[model samples]
Target: MSQETLSIAGFNVSPHHYIGGQRVASGELFDLHCPIDQSLLGRISEGTPAHVDAAILAAQAAYPAWSALTAAERKPYLDRFAAEIGKRADAFCQLESNDAGILLSRMKHGVIPRAMLNITWFAEHALSLQDRPLETEQATHIVRHDPAGVVVIITPWNSPLMLATWKLGPALAAGNTVIIKPPEWAPLTSSLLADCAHAAGLPAGVLNIVQGSGAGTGARLVSDPRLARISFTGSVPTAKWIAQAAGANLVPCSLELGGKSPFIVLEDADIDNAAATGALMYRNAGQVCLAGTRFLVHSDIRDHFVAAMRAYVEKLNIGDPRDIAVEIGPIIHPRQVERVKGFVERALADGAELLWGGKPHPFGAQYFEPTMLTNLRQDSEIVQNEVFGPVLTLQTFDSDAQAIAMANGTDYGLGGVCYGETAHATAIAEQVRTGFIWVNSFGIRDLAAPFGGIKRSGIGREGGDWSFEFFCDVKDVVLPKKPFRASFSHR
Candidate 1:
């Protein structure tokens, strides 16, 4: 290991972090760096197939006690965990902001606080247990929610802690043992989360973590027969692989993948309001999964919308992650920066006009200027793919019906936004085919709502009680007064 490598609890580490029952130190290694400065952060030993096996075994071993404990028993641990997280909130925010190239101010004020809130939400949700009831002629029956066996949680680099907590909190609160695989690119917060749990006196082996890429570590975890469920947040290609593995093992899996969500600016929409709200696409440098990359504006107001958007993007300050005033940070990696640039180039070649920003940022390795492209072909790669960068493609539609149709034309149906007069936006929202749609807003998510995608965006759901169902199993217990009936209709 070089000076760029970090020493964690004695061993030299990579950007990736792992926490198996016994510490591991083998297999491939990945370099972690700051997305803004490209400075080496650390290295993590990429786990092998053997490592995944060991992790699954450890999780299986820990399941009994971890699942057997009552909600009352688990409450204190997460409560303490949340308190500790709050204590070091500043450090956690700083680490994530630097590593992921997220804006320091937003990370400190928005992302970090929301992550902590997720922990608190789960802690409180654990205390309240509610079940649905079914009525019958003879008697009443209730559906009981019980924890599934072992759970495999795979979280992506974008919004690492917040997304991980969304799965980790519910899975743990539901009493299922968990095995987490943090992204190699952003493992600091994941390690910090494990540390938080450890400091809160969580039992060893209850929440196991292994560091590695999606190919070996994550794939093996989902495929392991010991796992009863897999909760994953990543790309669509990887989600398909996880789904295949889960099917092979006959285990349930929940996936939340990429999106090319549309943000429609209706004819009657307030141009200023729409522009301001759509600016969130550049937030976190557009690394968010639910970012609105497709801007569909009604042709009647297309020119005005584009002008407002251009002005908004040109004003965004792009630079160091440490800058308090800088709203847009880097792309989180050189590869991503290159990918975003490539898309812009392709758009240019395909006859799309660059409305404002679209180039290597003046500052860092991962930085790309907030870019806006108009007159883009609907068939262009930039319009079809999820360009996870601070870039947006503006498209126009003749009618509200046409806008909704175009918005839902892709294989993805993750999220969308409708901006217009109150009545019109609400009307458009109804026709937009997405799991979540914002009225006059973009990228707004809540812990209480059901969050997920439709079609290619990914399957199943996350957040609220919906996620809890993924890690639970239902058993039908019947006590009949007469002999059991075999009729299709339970008469």
Candidate 2:
């Protein structure tokens, strides 16, 4: 491969879809660009409805054999897939960094490694499945978990590979074949994932990749009656559309959507650590769905917390993502930059105080300064909506109840953080309406814990045994007693 081209598994794979264990070109193609420098990365095959149908057909064909394999039998293949991904860790990190504009160092140390761990974890989880017995006086009953065939996984661009693994890991572990529709902006890593699966000797059509826009490939996949389930991670609006389409076919769906999460700093909290953790609002250019963009502080320590947060945000290194030293990279694209900017401008118009940076970074066209806002109404758009940018809004509350109320006020209930005395924090964490809450921490995640949101954030969970249930259908079987005793009704 030349500097201008990207190849996967020794194949010059520009402008093609990985379907039925082969790379096939489409009649049309879409240009992929590196957001870091606005450079053309390459073209990817523009997936159409016909392409989606082909991928679905392939997955359906492969499902019976794949699902028939025992958990013990499937472990080695999944383990080998993890091993292949580990072998190409550096390549994956670089590709994802270039494609998504995330810091290469972050990808190497965080995202890519997590992707490998996610696959291995789910593979191990598969072995733990067992049938449950239901007690009965006159009959024997057993509940079995079975695979839901032909799962469609639609992943978002910000953390594509990691999020894909969140869905694919269990979907495959539960013995379902998958068709992955990666966001067009970040399709390379997923294609490479298919390559890894192929090299690991995964059966053909067991895993397929279709690359295109949501309006094209994603819509078709959700509408396909052959699909048993759909797992989607993206915006709330898109998840709604996916749910509607899946509903038409009565397909089971797990959606992990957007968030306007909250971070509360109480008077008794460790101000220094709280500020450091709260600064995660700027991580991934604040593209993370679990980001704590809303800050609720106790009025007693509000000034001190604001000062600490401002100092921390000012020190974030904004530069080329390829540079390992840089902390903040470019936004995903120019449109995202504008979208983030619009949020800030609207907040200002709504009388929110611009206490810190609020404009594009002076160094890059797609870079926005980590912004901080204060004195905003709780119902303001900036506080209520998902900014999905390097922006944070601050408000002070008089009491614990007030803080909890403010945190739960938004339509989103994805993630929340409570920082203070452990007991107090834990108490508040329980009251927050979000699906996941942290006490004194911000972004800590455990694979064993359920992860998803409530309200407008999303529907259904996606980790631990929750994922197992989501990808599997449960059936109850009852066996009659050998004596076949009949009950007599009283006159």
Candidate 3:
């Protein structure tokens, strides 16, 4: 998001399916639980297959006009939409905090601004994107970027507003109408986002959000044959299902599935600096896909690094997410808390050391402690899989090669971090299989740089022109410089 500190106020929430720029309520509904206190946030109308159909039709109807507009022509709508969201940044922050148990400060500082940034950035980038032209004696060939038809964006709950816009910005900038399916747990933001678009005077059916269970609503949306693109940020199984569904229609897809990314620390690394960065496993309560949950430290400094991490994590204020001063908050869901606890329990049974914080905090079952584990076997289930919590596992490596090997061993190759002298750390980072890495820092975002993953972590790159590339189709058009003779006569 944005690095600068900004003031937050408040915003309104809507309850309905945003179709054709109108609120359509449903008889059937689902419950939204607040993870901070395990309270029922509210009951949201469930989006059925019918709702999905309506949204798809709405998007299809809007597509002709939206896609007909040039990227430059489309920029005004994006700009106004961003302006609407910016005005409600404060209220958006509080609602997200209440809805998803994220620290309010984090939502303000690291997440909310991203919605505005994503839309504005992609709109500008689309304007800057140049078409490829090749000239020959006979003709000139140009590769033109055209909008894909209607798009379906399935966003994850961990960072709903930011992640949804991550795909939404490019999809809209490329002049495609979009339908978003927000995770049932944190569905409010998407509805509110839809309201923002409507308030910004966006045309009816240009941006739609359908909310409900993945099986009923999401399954129906992806299975539709009219989709031109499907961009998903979620689990592997769901992405696999999307791939299959899209496969049937020959529809293109981009999946940003979560990662079990690794963070490698060399013997020469700065202990305090490395520890502080590693402690960020607790950021966003460690629900982030790019979190470095696995720590591969040098054997000589493993103990010291773990000690420093424990000190850093312990100081974090863990409680109600609405509290501006709290550094850590609850896990997004109750089952996720139990799942995180289970991973640590299994590791403990397998002889892993519990360096610190293994169970639910005194706050309740919904809040997990900032957990740390060491003495883990590299082949163990906990070591090899994703915990998706405030859990950190420490594994010592005897050499840089071994650290890189251990880091690359996971099926995930999303984001990795290496810490040491610049050249040495960068040398090791060069061999790491992940799509992106930082030598001594963490979460330094560059929207112009390529971001995504290799292996099972994800399928494509995004940001800058890459986003335009995915959301737009390239068609070669050739024009003869002079009148052409008949081919048969030339033969």
Clashes of each: 6, 0, 3
Question: lDDT of each prediction vs. the true structure?
Answer: 0.78, 0.87, 0.86
Top model number, lDDT: 2
* Model 1 stretches with alpha carbons more than 4 Å out: 1-23, 130-132, 479-491
| Tens-place lDDT digits, model 2, residues 403-491 | 99999999999998889999988998999999998898867888999999999999999889999888999888888767676789877
Candidate 3 residue 275 Cα shift, in angstroms, is 0.7
Q: Give the candidates in order of TM-score, highest first.
A: 2, 3, 1
Per-residue alpha-carbon lDDT of candidate 3 for residues 419-456, written as tens digits (9 for 90 to 100): 98889999999999998988899898878988999888
Of candidate 3, the 10-residue stretch with the lowest lDDT total is 1-10
Itemize residue pairs with steric clashes in candidate 2: none
Flag clash pairs in model 3: 9-90, 10-91, 11-91
Alpha-carbon runs more than 4 Å astray in model 2 = 1-14, 134-140, 479-482, 486-491
RMSD of each: 3.1, 2.3, 4.3
Give per-residue lDDT, candidate 2, residue 327: 90
